[model samples]
Target: MTYDIAIVGAGIAGASLAAAIGARARVLLIEGEDAPGYHATGRSAAFWSETYGGPDIQPLTTASRAALQAGGFLQPLGSLHIGRPRDAAAIDAFLAEFADTPVRLERVDPAAIVPGLRPEWTLGVSEPSCAYIDVATLHAAHLATARRAGAVLATRAPFHAATRAADRWTIETGAGIFQARVLVDAGGAWGDVVARAAGVDPIGIRAYRRTVVQLRTDPPAPAGLPHVAHIAGRFYFKPEPGGRLWLSPHDEAPTDPCDAAPEEIDVATAIDRFEHVVDWRAAAVERRWAGLRSFAPDRRPVYGFDARVPGFFWCAGQGGFGIQTAPAAASLAASLLLGEDVAVPVDPARYAPGRFGR
Candidate 1:
């Protein structure tokens, strides 16, 4: 049978897109893993902050607010950035860069911050617009919605090859073959690989490894503790459930696309940075894992129809903002494929794939 759209990689990007398109098109969602969201989507820190990405990405973040709230995917958890005296210039630059964004951020005195902090942190900037996202629930909700809307979702169906036939493309996978008028590539770190396999020119998407560690705290879970990050963002710590804390050194080393693993050095660096910032001792590491955040050369998402390949579309390179911006991004992708009006508030120029060719 033939489908209107065939989406590769059932991560947050693909699943969300599938859900957004709904019954407007016959959509086929394929994933190589035993289940959906088994890669970077499943390993995300899952925070929704309007101040996170670049200026161009602000519209997407703002546009996603309503969907996320209506879906009950967000919780009230504010975020704060702490910096030392020597880092004043960097913090000032950050505040100035994001001043026009919707995030409610304000700088506070270092002495005022030291009282609430663990005594090690000094200067601080707080944003009330930040919140925690229930990532698993969000992913599951989208998948369920897509299925209910008559979308075909196939797990463990790895795409092996693709060939254009007339106006449609035949895609062969381990499970079966399917034909579609349009193809969406949301393969995360392996996005370029899938594009090349389908005879599409790669847009130079690079995957960078990011390592994170979960540690068991000594006493309270720090549930209400503000998500903390230094001025340079070399490390960050946030409260987790069950008396645990998620820590990361903000490591971004270049890596090949695969199941990423944490390096010992990265873990050690995170621990050292944590020690310097807080008095808490990381007695034992409960768990450690790594995931790749794919980026375009310009460090923004790529979303548009392939200029050379008529029916091929690009929807990868979300970096770490995939979960937070999924709703708007998916809406944009669906609009582009269905030739419908852009529903979200974001401008097409910021995320268009053609920008890379210029």
Candidate 2:
């Protein structure tokens, strides 16, 4: 069947774009897994801090607040950054950079760090506006909205080949053959692979492995505790729903695109980092997993059409901000495909794929 647009990968990026464009065009949303969000989108830390991304991405975060609030997917979980006296300079720089954003960060004394924070952390900052996102709920909501708007969603439908003729493109996939006038590559870590298969030049996209572990803690966490990150983001810990603590070393080791598994060494490093920074001991590790965060050579998300391929579009290289920046990113993609002007507050030039050529 022919579609107006065929979106590869049904994660946050693809799903959001599908939902946005479904009303305007026939969208075919395909996923490799049995279900959507089985990869990085399912394993995110679920934060909505505006200070998380670089200058190029901050405007998107700012513009997405209304949608997030209207959808009821955000909760004020708050975030705190703690560091030793030696790291004060780094902390100062962070404060100065985010001073004008919606995120309200305040410097606090060591004692004011979370109630049980280790005394070793003498300098701290708290961002009251930072919040936790309900990722699964948000993803489900978008998928439902897209399906209701007449978009076809197919799982376990990995694209195998693509060929373009005139203004149309034909794609062969595990599910079946499909045709579309436009193609969106939102395949997360497999973005480069998909582009190459579609006869487009790979855009130097790289994936990095990030590991997270859930641990059962003794005495549980004190009430009102906020998500805490060590200086340089070497490690981070947040309260989980079941009185558990989710921790990560914030490691970004370059990795090939594949199903990632947590390395023992990475888990051990996370444990050590947590132990050094927190007063409470992590009693037992209950579960562990890893996900791949893809980025371009410039560390910014690449969006818009492929310079060499007329009907092919790019919406990859989101890195860790895929979930946080979904609203604006999807809107931008839809705008580009529909030949409409960019409506989101983000500058199109910063995220355009053509930036790599310069």
Candidate 3:
């Protein structure tokens, strides 16, 4: 049978888009893994910071707040952008960059960097409005909404190939042959691979591996501590349960698409970075994992139709902001899929696939 829209790769991008468009279209969410979000969405930092994606992404991040907060998926946990004396200029640049946005960031003095921060971080910026996102809950809720609206979700249905004819896409996958009026390439790390299989040229979408580790601190991580990141963009850490802290070396190594695993060197680098920012001892590493953060050449998400391939939608290249900006991303994508205008004022052309040229 044919569907109005068939979304490939049911991660946050696919799942959220499915939910958003299900009400007005016949939606089919196809996932290669046995479950949705087995990749990046499942291994997220689980935090929602407006400034996480830089200035270009703040609009989407800001637009998603209302929907994310509707279900109480956001937990209040402010953030600290700590930096050294040499980093003062970088801090000033960051402030100037987002000065017009709604995100609240204030100057943090050396004395204000307390609550366990090391002395080396002499200058900083603090955002009191940031919070931790309940990713598991958000993913589940979106999938459920899609199902309730009559969207079909197929797991373990790895997409193989596709051919377009007479405005219909005949797709082959592990499940079976299916047809769709519009094909959405939300394949995450394999977005370009999927586009190529669907007879579209690759748009230079690349995937990079990012590593994170959980460390046990000697003084024990306090529950009241805010999430912290280096102003120069080297590392970030946040409090975890059982006196542990979630830290990352913020390493973004170029890598091929696959099930990502953390390297020992990356973990060691993370611990070493953490030690420099805090006087507390890192007792031991409890857990470590890595995930792919896919991105376009310009580092912005691509969320429109393929200019060369009719009926093919490009909804990939979410980078690290996929979970944080899910609501807005999906809404914008759904609007374009349905040939409607977006609720937000931001132009969709900024993320259009046409920019790459066919």
What are the Cα lDDT values of the candidates? 0.86, 0.87, 0.91
Ranking by lDDT: 3, 2, 1
Clash pairs, candidate 3, are none
- Residue-pair clashes per prediction, in order, are 0, 0, 0
Q: 164 in model 1: Cα distance from truth in Å?
A: 1.3
Q: CA lDDT of 49 in candidate 1?
A: 83
Q: Give me candidate 3's TM-score against the actual structure.
A: 0.98
> Candidate 3 overall Cα lDDT vs. reference?
0.91
TM accuracy, model 2:
0.97
Evaluated at residue 27, the lDDT of candidate 1 is 93
- Of 1 and 3, which scores higher on TM-score? 3
Q: Which number leads on TM-score?
A: 3
lDDT of 3 by residue, 1-358 (tens): 8999999999999999999987799999989999999999999988999999899899999999999999899999889998888987899999999999899999877446456677677887889879999999999999999999999999989999999999999999999888999999999999999999998999998999999998888899876788999889899998877878899999999999999999999999999988888888999899899999999999999999988889999999999999999999999999999988797657898889888776
Model 3: per-residue Cα lDDT at residue 332: 97
Residues 90-154 of candidate 1 have per-residue lDDT tens digits of 88898898887676778875445332345545678887778899999999999998999999998
Every candidate's CA RMSD: 1.6, 1.3, 1.0
Q: How close is candidate 1 to the true structure, as a TM-score?
A: 0.96
